[model samples]
Target chain A: DAGITQSPRHKVTETGTPVTLRCHQTENHRYMYWYRQDPGHGLRLIHYSYGVKDTDKGEVSDGYSVSRSKTEDFLLTLESATSSQTSVYFCAIRGLYGYTFGSGTRLTVV
Target chain B: GIQVEQSPPDLILQEGANSTLRCNFSDSVNNLQWFHQNPWGQLINLFYIPSGTKQNGRLSATTVATERYSLLYISSSQTTDSGVYFCAVPYQGGSEKLVFGKGTKLTVNP
Candidate 1:
């Protein structure tokens, strides 16, 4: 609850469709990250933004993309959703103490 | 990329019991954190113990950087403590990009 909010807490979509998730932060933290959680795989980094308009890919960047055009918003997009991408997505903001994570978005691809 | 490993992949305990979860990293890290994913799928930041020890309420964490391992101790566990506990670390001298372990799933019964 560190001033972070994720939209569409739960989503279900068919394969080959486009999907986008939004993460909004009020703390104006300098770093933002997207991660996915799955059974047996833990949490895998998908993408991260160090500053406004500055982004970097993570270990599991394939089939996904991220954009941070403003300090308060970061977006994760799936160009063509697939069942393999079904998982709980989490967004985090880096603070001096540690990271603050959003509640998470449960996305299912049918 | 640093590799993180968590032990005792699954744990079950009764109320008032105490348990320890361990995380080992393959490389040196400057940042190490512990998180609790509640049944509601919210990732709660538990600790940011890069070194030394820190405690909050019924939870305490110790990180022995020299040994490349960290331990999270939960005392007087409750049914509310049942969820996944994850330990994550970042590569040496890199941005705060975390690599997470598979997590230790804890199930506490009343």
Candidate 2:
């Protein structure tokens, strides 16, 4: 197991509310990624960080934002949650061999 | 951006049966990986086969970059392997961001 943990494993929020999911990794990986999985969409990247303070958006990054102030923590925030944003989010840390993912965070917006 | 395709959007097999999942990439990729999303929604890394073949327990994977496809083999499938299997590839010269296939949903019956 890669020492990866996702905070607030489950969350329920109302639409228009702000939600933040945190991913923490004990391994000093240089690459970190945030992805969301929805029915029929598989897993789509939202944002990723190559190093502290260096981040980039992905295909479905329209309503999402990410920040990495330290190597261990990567955060994903939804400025205003929407019904469409109700999905399972996963955080991953890149390794030389492969990537290790967190347990995932299930967020539901109503 | 590269395109990734996964075959057999859904699969059903008995506990002792064997199966194979495929992933096709539209372009050359520098990194290729396979992941298994368990029932709990945790994504676990299965293999990082950008080329050649590799095996771990009852799971094995082979990627032929020349052919632009990868295959994952599950031998003697167990009920525990009954989630979704995703294949992700990083485009060449990219920032190590992975483009994921829609994934194959596997249902194992005892």
Candidate 3:
């Protein structure tokens, strides 16, 4: 709701292919996060950025990487898409009062 | 890292029923947020309560930071409320990253 947007709402990629999901925020938040939601695994953090060019791995960071070249854009890259990575990816920005999430991007690996 | 646990993995209720979803955190925190994910895979932030009580229409939340738990109460639940409810706490007190619970799935039938 904080003017956050996710691109490529849905995507299907071959295994071992590289895919990138973009999160753009008009508010220019400093903290951004990437999470994957699976049926039983819940929402697991993949990576998060505290500032431009500063990122850290989360609980499930393997196979995923993130980059924040600017204050309004955060990119999540799947190094080599796998079946396990097929799920809905959410991008969020930490707000002053709470966290705001994008519409989410659903990715499928074939 | 902090751990979050939600009770009643699934619940079914008639439209107009009232329900309480609970979240327990492993450590005390100054911030706890609640979210609702609809069937369309949109994550909506419902509450940013770290302590005390906050209400918005038919939904309200209370977080007891001292006790390390939070409660989300929904009154007169509607069919549109059928979704997954999640609670998250900062990784460590006020870290930028958040740890989320598996979530409580609510089904509000008419």
**lDDT string, candidate 2, A1-110, tens digits:** 58999989999999999999999999999899998988888888899999999999888999998989999999999999999999999999998888899888999999
Tell me the lDDT of model 3 at A1: 64
Model 2 misplacement above 4 A: none
Model 3 clash count equals 0
The sequence of per-residue lDDT tens digits that candidate 3 reaches over residues A1-110 is 66999999999999999999999999978999999988889998999999999999999999998899999999999999999999999999998988999999999999
Q: Which candidate is the best by lDDT?
A: 1
Docking category of candidate 1:
high
What tens digits encode model 2's per-residue C-alpha lDDT throughout B80-99?
A: 99999999998545558888
Residue A59 CA displacement from its true place in model 3, Å = 1.0
TM-score of each: 0.97, 0.95, 0.97
Which segments of candidate 3 are over 4 A away from where they belong? none
Local distance difference test scores for all models = 0.93, 0.92, 0.93
Per-model TM-score (chain A alone): 0.99, 0.98, 0.98
* Residue pairs with backbone overlap in model 2: none
Interface RMSD of each: 0.6, 0.7, 0.7
